[model samples]
Target: MENAPLPSKPHYAILDGLRGVAAVLVVIFHLFEAHATSHLDQIINHGYLAVDFFFLLSGFVIGYAYDDRWQKMSIGEFFKRRLVRLQPMVVMGMIVGAAFFYFQASKLFPMIAEVPVWKMLLVMLIGFTLLPLPPSLDIRGWQEMHPLDGPGWSLFFEYVANILYALFVRKFSNTALAVLVFLSACFLIHLTITGPNGDVIGGWSLTPEQLHVGFARVLYPFFAGLLLCRTIKLTRVNNAFLYCSLLILAVFAMPRIGGADRLWLNGLYESFSIIFVFPLIVFLGASGAVKSNFSARVCKFFGDISYPIYITHYPLIYTYTAWVQDNKIPIREAFPVALLVLASSVALAYACLKLYDEPVRRWLQKKLGPAKVYQKA
Candidate 1:
């Protein structure tokens, strides 16, 4: 107790605000999923950037939550805390996803008539393991997994980032500076090098070490966000950072970043994004500053349910879309229906939190105790 790294209580409102933004981003992205599939890919394709924001935001939160505490607890405690937070929803989501797939399968081939029993079950297995998800060929070139949202990929990474952060980031004395330098360097190196997937490699370049570079580039922000936990405690984030996060968020809507164009610019926008958005969020929340200014109540509201909003929105997207297609509503007409799906998802998720998520989280603390993270001996 006396030996804890630092006695600190984070501003929970920041987390709430972050979750609010993440949920909205995911919602906006889901809107694109609807538009793209129903009839809009040709017009716009960068909706998936919501996943990036989620990952970045996740990194920031983890840093805020456990950066200091990482040194105080045993590795077992860290994992138990994570399991308590993650496993219930994860397992439940998997089961629900499988059931939805089966339900649709029943109608399609109608399980009684033609479900490849093994294959149907296998798809769920793959999904739960975080393997490849089925793509909607009927949609654009982009693939869709029926009965589930596409952004689950980031959740997997969030788990990974948290573990890695606990291991590396939590061990540092000067963590903020170290992570900032390390993460920023890795990001730069990634853009310089090309990937087997074909990033760019020319005048200003590094090595084509895809796995290393990509891992570093993707993770550094989370690490940076962890570092941000420390930085935000001292200095107010620059106003430019906020404007920048919003700007890059706009860029996040572009597909070229995922395409051949990424060769020259893949990591650029993310770097810019973290530089601007992360700090802006930290600054705004920490200093009580606002740009165009939404009401504090609204901001606080979104912040409150951001986690449930993050966890529960996807299933609604799938169930709603499936209903749309089966019922034969046109995309233009279906936007309202889809919006209903989005709102309902948020509401249902929020209700579940009141009824379940919050109580469960608290129970986890009582049973598992306060979440902890530290280096493994």
Candidate 2:
């Protein structure tokens, strides 16, 4: 009886383009990350903030899509829809990471070459379930919860946010939601300001410390974005796409706020950016329209490939980083290959979307029968 007649709202097309832009920046960030010794000198310095932006976007989109539909949708049905939309790429990402593991042999992770094939396969199998593995089982020395694919760690927390929403957060009234978000923001501010690194940078590993950082990273922006959705009004803007896109880049491109002596300055910058700036970008993106066919197509293409690219591209980064380290080549010298890796990552994401993810989701939707689909328009 639930999910019988709920009509899905149209997606914010500019926001989709913005997501693609952020994802691409992340790839660039990682590429430069291969050459840097520390976060301060990382070329695309603030790119890691993309994850926080993603969490904010997720909250906003989820609130837009699901808040009013709860009367017609059950928790089980909500989980099913999310799984259908997200799980396919997750599976494919693990597979791709596994297939490319051997190719990533380098000094950064020298043990990668010696990791037995069976152990790699085992790690891949565990990865497919979106579960975290302990340090003893970390095939890659990086200590990522999902050793096969480093980015899977964020996906893992994403699942947590969804579960929390389905069971608890969705029940809060607007006032209550705002209060929760404010409290979470306070906690996040504390974590970022007092931390040794002066950034919200952990959460990949299985350590207790990283787990704390992960939660700190996810809690506020997600709920705040949701609250923003429920409260703010959208107003029309000219060149909204360009402006929002540039603003996002500026946010991530921001330099470390202070030198090493005043680490909290950087943390303040990060906290303010996440708390105030990202939501404004989303609001602007949602408020505007794609006025031309070219922009529309670009946004559509990017939106279509963004998730696949994000979930699948890091293995290529691992390989590229390894290659760079193995050869003692500066990223400057390796620039051409980095370009190749970028192109290949995009092409591969497109291929997997056409060949696997779309087909599989379609099949799942068909077999699962009629249900609500909150697709981006």
Candidate 3:
């Protein structure tokens, strides 16, 4: 009976909608990224913060979904559940990236054409496992861990956070967890403030510095989110979905806080947002009820495609970025193409969600032994 499937829980629909919102912002951010020479000039300046927001959401969702099932569920089972949820999309993202690999060759990606088929396939195979490729294996000239799908870096850290939760952090008392969160918050603050970029903008590579950035970025938000789940007293908040969605957009759409000379100021702003604004948003999201059938449907639709869009959109962005760079088209003239890429990415993500991710996950769960009936938070 210990291995029996647990019943799934209801989702926080508003949180799911917010996640979809953030994922969309991340896509727009990446599109703008192709044009910006520096972070300051980037149009959606704080869009990178969306990753941090995701970590927060993940932490909250994981806690809400799993914190109480440990007596009945083994660590191995917990991992299997996570794998079923995440690994399918990871593989799809890598496959999508591999399929688009050759077409992305341009001045922006000089190494794409030089990369051999065998090497590219090898990378794709490695990517299926979500293992971080060392710089030596960087096929696309960018020093991304998963060069095929760059955003897989966050997923990698996400797995690390999960491992820590399963092995150690999940057992920590609220007080202990609070201490850890405090120290992690301090580390996050220091890393963001003192960094050359004056922002929490890295964690894609395998080097010591990037790894430090990644850990700092993941630890605080993820654990803070977990801590919030354990301690939060959710109050009834009216119109939480609407209010939280707008707040998230406003945060991501914010301008760079400080320019080159005052990087610490930007760091402080980021720190404040992660430490305060994000958790508040999560609390509100969780507290708010999905009152209307229309609102419920909207939340469900966004929630359904959120992960698919996030995991799968970057490959398309790579192609779009290449098209812009190869043609030497100005961002102003390239606006139409950018819009097309955005719409196409949305279409592609929804298609993958329906055609591949859901089917593959359903198959995996059935074959993998006792299906853990966890919430789709």
Q: In terms of lDDT, which candidate is strongest?
A: 3
| Candidate 3 lDDT by residue in tens digits, 1-377 | 43688888877988988899889999999999888877899898999999999999999999999999888889998888899999999999999999999989888899998999999999999999999999999999889999999999999999999999999999999999999999999999999899998899999999999999999999999999999999999999999988998998888888888788999999999999999999999999999999999999999888888899999999999998888767778899999989999999899999999999888888987788766564463
- How much lDDT does candidate 1 score? 0.52
lDDT of 1 by residue, 1-377 (tens): 32233344535444455556656666666655544542123233444444444555556666666655645666666667666666555544555555555444322223323445566566546556544354431111223332243444455556677777666656766655564657565664555444443332111111234234435444656666556656655444444334433643565455545455444454454455445555555445555443444544655667666666666676566656556556766678887776787787678667866877667766876675554332110
> Which wins on TM-score, candidate 2 or candidate 3?
3
Ordering by TM-score: 3, 2, 1
Clashes of 1: 10
| Better model by lDDT: candidate 1 vs candidate 2 | 2
The CA root-mean-square deviation of candidate 2, after full C-alpha superposition on the true structure, stands at 1.4
Index of the highest-TM-score prediction: 3
Order the candidates by lDDT, highest first: 3, 2, 1
- Which 10-residue window of candidate 1 scores lowest in summed lDDT? 198-207
Model 1 scores a TM of: 0.68
Misplaced by over 4 Å in model 3 are none
lDDT of each: 0.52, 0.88, 0.92
